[model samples]
Target chain A: MVLAFKNETFRDDFTFSNSPAAIRRFPFPFVEDKYMYSVNIEPHELGPKGSVYEFPIDIDEHYVSEMRDRALVLDADPGRCQALPHMITAQWDMLELLMTSMARDYPEHFSLTRDGNQWHWINRPLGIDHKFTFGDVATLPYQPMEYIGRQCQGDFSIQDQRDGQLWMDAGIITTQADWSLDFDVGMNFFEWHAPVPLAHQAGVFDRALKFLLNMQHGRPVRRLNWTMTINSRLDTSPENYHKWGIDRTTVTPENVGDKVHLRVELQALWRLPRSNAILFSIRCYMIKMRELATVPKWGRRLPRVLRTLPDEIADYKGLTRYRQTTIDWLSKYDDGAPTSLGGGPD
Target chain B: MSTIKSRPIYPGLSPDPNARRNVVVCDAAGAEAVVELLARADGEFAGRTSVVLSSEGLFGKESESIVERLKPATVETTAGLVPAIDRLKEILASATMGLRLYAAGSEPLIGSVVQAGAENFIDPLSVRTEHRGSLKRRVQCVHCKGMTENVTTNPVKCAQCGLLLLVRDHYSKRLAAFQGVCINAETPDESPELKVEFQ
Candidate 1:
């Protein structure tokens, strides 16, 4: 079996499975039990009607039972092990489908993770292939990377919606065009959504380059002192991408009585490693949307909120635990792509 | 000269003559978006035409960076580069890191020439109107809204009015005014594509 074959999944289709065996292979999209939380929400006009549901397991229990039947402390069959490539490919494929479905199914609730909070988001079609290096090497400091003017090959996926996902086959030292942010980064989804307007930049990925200027008031917006550090090592800070873009949009006084929303996205690059150290394309997004998104106490609970029907727990034994959350947003939907980061509340 | 317009729907104790020009402390996102909204409305609806995006302090450096990235035209000064209108000025400016969730609800100040929601900012024709009304009416107090009888001296007590007559010191009031650096629209994000090579 090949270690890294390019195509993530067999089909381009978002819905339906090939066949339903007493045991199935691909499962429906879901969140982990450890991460799920109860939220009180009032849906917008275009909100979804879905109840809460946990993420599904792609493996079948019958197979696990079969291995156990072999005895001797559970047979020669590797319980969760499959062809390594098959698992990787399946995960990537399913993630893409899930991202698109989430956008299509729930547009209003679509978001990206920003400023340490969560929100809703939709989907965007992506580029074929590219690869990149981890910015923060334990041994490297105060030194510009030698791979600045280089190229690699891999598919790119950026999903900033509430349930966005990203998967890429990458190499060390390459750059990406698509930007995204607002979600957690794990083995499954590496990059989040890219912020609007700032998606495209003009320089090399400076470890600490200046981004988004003029954050203060009453001065000529100047362009110096924009040094910053972008972290890309999955093992170290696998929660996100190194490079990103942001836009601070607003409601003008002319519009009068409107809320402000900031659209943002995070980006990263990855290369599968050849050493004992595993190559990780890792990260996720989380946003506050605190002001924009209210964890408000509503007058009454609607029958259908952001809830999933409760299900019986499968065994949690031997499961490697992940302990983090992420979020990010779309550029446009109700309005045109965020035209510009204009100022003031109308 | 910009304008100030206040539209407070709720009644208040300090609502008495609240139409004074002032500044607001907007967090990162607040300064950028809020200023744009305020400027646009002041220019379009309130006739505070051409109010600019001015800045000062640490905001200028980054603002300048963004000004260069988004509206590069604002940076040049050769004829075509010259702004037809003026905007607010700042000291420092930079770019947003694509994840500025920290600035959501902070409202900065919008210093207009008039109230936040005034019918007019500066009656450009007012000078002429006052010219027709004579020197006595030209030197009226902006705050007290009364004519300065002596035009030059502060009236301790006036025969025509009971209260002390106030006069505007145009020279002192207009000095140290924050000016705009985006004399022209310059930042153009045509593309910021970074080249990546595989190792």
Candidate 2:
């Protein structure tokens, strides 16, 4: 598919918005009228054409702008992209995964040509064509992971599997949801997720860890996780909480439709062939409440889901202040009507 | 939710009789724990043990008394926790097999000792730890990534960024500090009431 990439900004005078087509393929997270924590993982198999899951790596209209935002973030805070010394091999593994998937899935926008260890890659959208040795870091302009991660559309983390646990050894996370990659760099699965409430007692991590540990090469899995962002802002990191947290307070019934955004993460994990590490990709999709309400089924279902959300969850997702206002606004579209079963617009 | 999964749990110290060399790292308030650990050991354990004591704030006299009572093979005393950890690192540098590391002190001291051990290729979970002193915490500001030591309040101010932060039990062994995030970020002017929860 040839995508007419949008020119937008995710910060300061936020001009980011979703087109009608973008909203249709937004990866709406709710499968029902209510929501709660669950393992919700599924095989990352190809979905219906034009859907987000149609390809392993989904690059949409936001690709160029998102990459630009990532570059701006890296220029300001280079620590956002870090890799431990031992994760060098895993870095190359991730580079290969992203390059191959992109070149194969979107042939027009990207291409990869290989001659033994020397490889050539062309990213037409970003206007880059480079040739370098695959295994050699000195041959590339940046480290393998950062080089490829800069071009990718989502936050990528590599988890080194050892001691029967997955350690978050390397990542390039600029558009995170209130988490700091610097603080969480060396943490294991359970340790990084320690701040989340209620999921631990439900044995969510325990089950999820077991499932990821045995992940085989060429067989990846995916799940959807979500939170509400006050704007179309992407860099909602804890490092900038003092700057953007104030947006939550600014939400009112008057501006709830334009300001409130449902941020959904399409999290996928693939076991790397060489490093025995898992590549975790978090592709964020943001749609404002106004754009989401265009879909009849989603407009009816979202308010019901928010109204029944547990207090602990609402607080944890940082939606306590704006949730009621957004729900009240969305309730106008919910005519006490029955919606479809799955997370699809009808 | 009573205990955070990432928060390290100190399984109170127990002497390892089979170890050829024993190293004990402690703060002033942890002297009692060291004394009890040595007392419980069988067969001349103190003869092969070395102690690193940090008598930083209070309990100076108590630390001196414990040193006099438990006359281990060698005792190195420092004015603060930083120097004690440096001494511990030097000792670990020359360490061989059959070495058992024991840390008994405030969470910061113990966590630092464990972190130093980890840098020397020793597994942190293998280090014996006993919480003995003040419940004061060491917190890392999630914003500026600056660490503030000896935090005694819940909603403490970040020493670097000046943001009033809520100290969370979510901890990092690698960083050896609890995570601190802005408390009233949304409503910046409204600061929550401070509580001496850590103390």
Candidate 3:
């Protein structure tokens, strides 16, 4: 997965040669620094017109209530070990990744609103004497995280729960170094989630478009993920993955960059009859004001200094596009505007 | 971890504060509900709906990477924070520690733990690489157990204590990252913070 880029001048482009992928240090750092914009994608004239579709996500309320009751009994009787409801919430977070990527791709199409996300593993033994049998500790109608929601094109781990969580880390799933479900996320990317205002979504999505365009231009797009500030919301942030005993893993602002291949056969990659993988690009940069990660009484959130994001804000008026090249068309399923462009030299 | 103190379930709390450093987290229901129920006296998580924001309070396994149990939680950012200033002041006014929450999930994505961090550990750079290169190659003696001169090779023997001391990862040969330097042993009388250089 080595990313190759043409521009080596900006801080956003690839700086590390040792890494298999050519990286992008900073693209439009000024925009991110000024307006609080994150990743940026340029318009792709040659890139395929991506398909847009949304899947439904509706969870049952009864299922949540029943399982929650059982979870209480287990925690009440500590000796009678049971997987707590909170562990299910952690699992819920993992399942959200694929779901969100899908939803974001079709914001105008799909809206997943699932309520009562709980899981009760029935048909499984709870205690040695089986005093707390499947139904006693868990209930039906409980929606597991895997059942939370999903949108995939290939044979993901979800096909087999016996192999554990249907997820893979960055490394290969091979023998010797077998089943490395360990994905190396960037350093600055935090584990968090909350309802952010729609005001910021547009700018963020715009960045994604720009990042994808860079990939179409042979500029490798690297890294894609998001974290939300919860101090304003609540202390129970996503990073508190109690199930895995992980507060944080090793990641840096430098690695989120992804090298998207536009010319690659995308249709063939879609394994399902109507399934498709979303195409997106992102540009991550080093923040000047590195706020320390802190824990509060009720919420755990990262710093909210939006001012120190990318580069100089006021200089966009004069800058122009460096070059003008027609894009190579692959395949498009939607009829919406494909290019997210700027007023730079065309 | 939650800063809102709670009495031990069914009985009383830990006699020592240090021993009371473990907490568990649940969802809107279960273990977390108990914390809110128990903290009625302290008025900690009682009225607040954020009872589930504490990572440790979730139905989870406890360990070090998480914040201290019973610690307070707060947003680390200060942007557009004027409105939160009054609220932040109120939380800080209360006594105790806090920790951040990790909630990751998205619209269609089921396992999005948004609060997770990518950093396993981070060491800030307070010194320049060039500045550290000017210092001499100081080594511990492997033979005599003494800080002696004239030894230029790896795994040098001490002249005084006769103890053999091997340089860790001799091939890495980095100047800025000086390892195994007992700055305290060099100057027991001076403050360790002030004793910057081995020279």
Candidate 4:
């Protein structure tokens, strides 16, 4: 059957539409001309609300399209989503957490009917009504987390909290912004983020780790991170570097405006009530430079940040090749708009 | 997109600047000239908030009817005579500050315009709309996933497939339309109900 609304067409048509939903919900990251990375984490409620992933688990307009993309990614690379054999409890915890969250947020479309050990979960959006007993893997067709993740829009991973640190152990991640789930699995929280520049030297990671460790069960924390991509491709992981990596260098100056995309990942970390595992959800969004330029301030600020950005950070971000050209294109709309252009003493 | 950037810019903390709040409204009849209206405000328009009003176009008119009426001047006023969506997009991309967008029109018109801003990541707080026109909707057929604009009936005919569809409250933001499910989905031989006024 033909899908009702294919995402590619929707994006192509809406990207240029003034005030299209895609441009409005886009999280423009640069606030000033000078650029630097720090522990930018914040409480989930404090950040701009209702733009993305409002609840612990959010189902948005892109839910169906993203889910379809995930399925394709999984089919192409089984290594994209995996759960260690010993992490079954965490998987079950995530499954329950996701179900309850969905049922609470979209009650009309999702419901969880429970009677003691037996429970019935209905996903109206997916048209799936499942009945299973709690804690019984056999009752479900697939692993609890995997089964639930198949329908989720965000990539999820669980970290076991112990020994004064959280260990990255289990997850179902098909759409990673950059890092690899297979490579980072089993690495401690700090180690997983080790590749991220400046966070460690600046003590941002230590402070964030402490904050994450002390996170209360009911409270969830989230933060927004952003970068630029060469194209609209969502699967920007290194695993398929050959597929998209070449585009980075080959894109000419004329097409750079339309080809370059701003990628923002909204990452939320939750302290699962039981099993003491932290569920991290990452949802990615991309808007090209031409569309992003519509936001006058965004168009202006982005280039200044890039032009003044140090080479190290630029290299780290894979922006070294096109940073200048991207800056030139964004500068067309800049008109020397008022901005903070120089870096301050750290 | 993953990049490792290493630049020791200002090593220290800097105060985060507040984004300039902008207001843009789109409707069948765009609001009055923004500059003149702001000139009449208690104080001057000191560039704190940029305002642009994109109203629907008038057929056979050489100049935008609203722009001609307002004859607005200054950076704060734009008599956007083209499709509000096109003008709004142009306004949104050029600003250097954060924006707050407002739309006033029919449900379908407002929803479609708002969906554009939502897609661009405009903060929900920064965006609001007052429904000012008809109660009709823009429906999307679930069976064919095609959008039918300006629908007025509950059991509307799907423009794409000619199927009788019962419109549901479920609005898909992606399609920016209420789902119109096939009325005879379960019963293949039964004649579907013809028409009913939408709420």
Candidate 5:
């Protein structure tokens, strides 16, 4: 979990080695050679076996490192962390929710005490114990969400429900999965997902929006979204595409397995109690094709999925150029093995 | 000549070095291989200390004698592999470079334990897994994100959210579970049979 970095900075020199631990835990998304978008939401619960999503605010080994990385990203670009004028109250709501969740889930590190409107927060991990009035901006150094966001691992956004739809109003997103909040702010739910194909035609987005609108304040829904990235870098927004996009093109057939990574975003949506705004959080995870191959069935399924992926979807995922090469590389794992497709190895 | 009943074992990955310190994790189904796994480890990793974790209720009673003979530190988990993994996290934190992890269980158990080891910075090269148990699917409800275990019915009820889920053939490696959509998705009230098999 904690790697010895070359320096005490989030620099390019940071190299990652594939560990057995990572391979076993890697969420292999491809059930078949092709993937599709669906409202794959599930309720959060503790299984007979422990699950990662058992708690609302999950504090894992990546907690400290991710928080540090967020700080570094925010320090470089304050724009990455923003709260709209209308979302001020929602920000405070989010701050309280996160604090309470963390305090409950991780008692050793976080604690929250309230005396009416005045609140006391102690974050042992970050070494901060402070007292602040609930609604007073001057009581905190930064915006309410950003202050708490700095302590949490995932990037967050708060969408206000008004005029019969949800608005993309407020968030602290330093690590985005391709989309930018700068352009998305103030846009309605459908407008925000305007680029996602078939959802509109099939009425999936409308149905989903309505379901979110009706979601109870206390209850939350979570879903998973996936994409492929060229490297392990977290900053892959369009603004930085020139930096990472080039790597996608440069990946050779022999190295594609090691270079390409499956980036999965575990997104959760919660309806805030007071403001009626939805708190959306995204946590990104990456695992390479070679590492994925360690899981026998997963190794067999991906190549077929790539071969059958629709052109439009493949282009949307930016898998146009390297799809064939990646498939060829994955073919090495088949070894005449049976796939879910039920045929002799291709 | 009489024939011996032969059931194929799940082809699990093996650790080459097998190291001096071992942590063996297993569930009920994987209990069959515990003796062989331990013997192999003992041969390669002589004089090493071990901590073995077994899923609740399923740890083999017959294996208990061999386990007692090895004098290995043991933990039995009732709340799935997550609790066992939480314990493993502490042991791995202080673990030395030569420590090797062996997992023998269902896919979810192995996956969860592997994730825990990975979180502790264990190299994949030092970890071996022998998948045992049923192919019965673990399905996650799309409505609630809660997972229902050992589901055989196509339209299975989600244990967490109480939704009638149609377990899709598509599996999610991240959750180490399959996607289960509402059976009555289009026609909210009129439930329809999935009439499809899990691939």
Candidate 6:
């Protein structure tokens, strides 16, 4: 079914909000009351009809607006989307994966017709219908990855697997939580995640890297990562942190419900068929504190997750300034009840 | 916790006897490390070695005195680290098989050599590094993307954008510098006291 794409802004006035349907499918990351680092991964298989995992490439109400914000970010800093010279083959692999998945899942909104090397793609929401030679970069308006990545909802990265490591060779990362793809473009999996506390000591990367290295062509894996943002701002990137960081101070007891947002990332990884590379898609979903409290389980669990959150992690996530305010606001919805087994709305 | 994994570590220089050629790049303070490294080397090492020294910083006189004692086949002295790196790049371009690369002195010097080696198809981790002299850093401002060299303070002011940046240990080998983010972005007026942590 076609989604009612929202005409919202992620910046300036910050008009972004989630509908009731959208909030129900929100990927609430905390499964239990307390949270800690883990290699929490699962197969990227189809889930129940209305869940975010219903499709390989999820397109929601925010798709149009998110894509627009991505364009604005790229316009301001072209460095946000980058691919090394060697990632050309992987770029085509990414285009094929996204196009086929999106078209198959949401046939109403997207269509892809392939006639050998010549391919025709129509994105109804964005109002684009283009025909191009599949493997040729000259036939497309932009590079293969950028052309398709701009159309997709999430931040996409392609990792070149070599020397028993995944290299962050290419990505379009406009909506990253705090990391900079420009700074981390060529870093290996371990190197790029160096800043994260406790996880390294926990051998999380070692196990995760081993798992990813052995990932096969048809199989894809998924995980959930989260961070908090002051507003419903999509570009919480370090590149523009100076502009948005001050929003942390704006949060108070009164405005916490409207101001604070829980940003969750549905990170999915696929092993590309052609390039032997991995396609890492990070789909960001943001819901305000007030909207999230509508779901009783989420409202209760989020506060517990925040209150008992490790000091190191809390600092690392940049929640030191406004965590107490957000927790105190969210606490009103919590009756100190135990959450259910999984991260689903009760 | 202060040591980040991405930040390159100096394992101290050791002579590679199996190498057909040896290229040693260093700054003024690194001359002692070179001397210490050469003390353990065999006589044949001196014959095959080419040394690039930059006597520009505070330890210049000490570096010269130490350089005088070296008996390598060739010694090339430059005005500073930038020129020394340029000379290293020239050598790397013409480098043949069985070449061993070693870098010493300030982190910037070592990082530049490693970066240049990486651009020339040499693995950065393969380059031997030894830290010496000033602990000052070379920071890249995340805002303006400017490279501020010789940053000594924790909340150092960006050389280009003038933003007070928190010098994070999170480093980038490709850029050969540490990441500097705006420290006072949340509360612009309240400035934190600058600490000379790096030096």
Q: Number of the top candidate by DockQ?
A: 6
Over the stretch B1-199, how does candidate 4's per-residue lDDT look in tens digits? 1122211011211111243554545444334323333455334222444434443343435335544443332223334423556666776677454555555545565555566775566643244555554567778664455677768777888888777777655444334456566655434466666664654
Give the proportion of true interface contacts each model preserves, from 0 to 1.
0.00, 0.73, 0.00, 0.00, 0.00, 0.76
What fraction of the true interface contacts does model 3 reproduce? 0.00
Model 3, A251: alpha-carbon shift in Å?
26
**Per-residue accuracy of model 5 over A212-287 as CA lDDT, tens digit each:** 9998877888877777877666766543443455566667987887678777777888889889899999877677
- Model 4 TM: 0.58
Q: What does chain B score (TM) in every candidate?
A: 0.22, 0.95, 0.18, 0.65, 0.71, 0.94
**Better TM-score candidate (2, 3):** 2
- Give lDDT for model 6: 0.92
- Give the fraction of native contacts in model 6: 0.76
Candidate number of the best TM-score: 2
Model 6 pairs whose backbones collide:
none
lDDT of each: 0.20, 0.92, 0.22, 0.65, 0.68, 0.92
- Evaluation by lDDT, superior candidate among 2 and 5: 2
- Docking quality level of the chain pair in candidate 4: incorrect
i-RMS, each model, one decimal: 21.3, 0.9, 21.5, 20.0, 20.7, 0.5
Q: Of 3 and 5, which scores higher on lDDT?
A: 5
Indicate the docking level reached by candidate 2.
Answer: medium
- Give each model a TM-score: 0.17, 0.98, 0.18, 0.58, 0.58, 0.98
Candidate 4: regions farther than 4 A off: A1-6, A9-19, A46-50, A339-346, B1-199
Which regions of candidate 1 fall more than 4 Å away from where they truly are?
Answer: A2-346, B1-199
Native-referenced Cα lDDT, model 2: 0.92
> Residues A268-321, candidate 4, lDDT per residue (tens digit)?
888887688899988777778878777777777788778888787776677877
lDDT of 1 by residue, A75-144 (tens): 2212111112223333333333333334344333222222322222222212112121222223222111
Give the B-chain TM-score of model 4.
Answer: 0.65
Taking the tens digit of each residue's C-alpha lDDT, what string does model 2 give over B170-197?
8889899998999988887897988998
Which candidate, 4 or 6, would have the higher TM-score against the true structure? 6
**Pick by DockQ: 4 or 6, better one:** 6
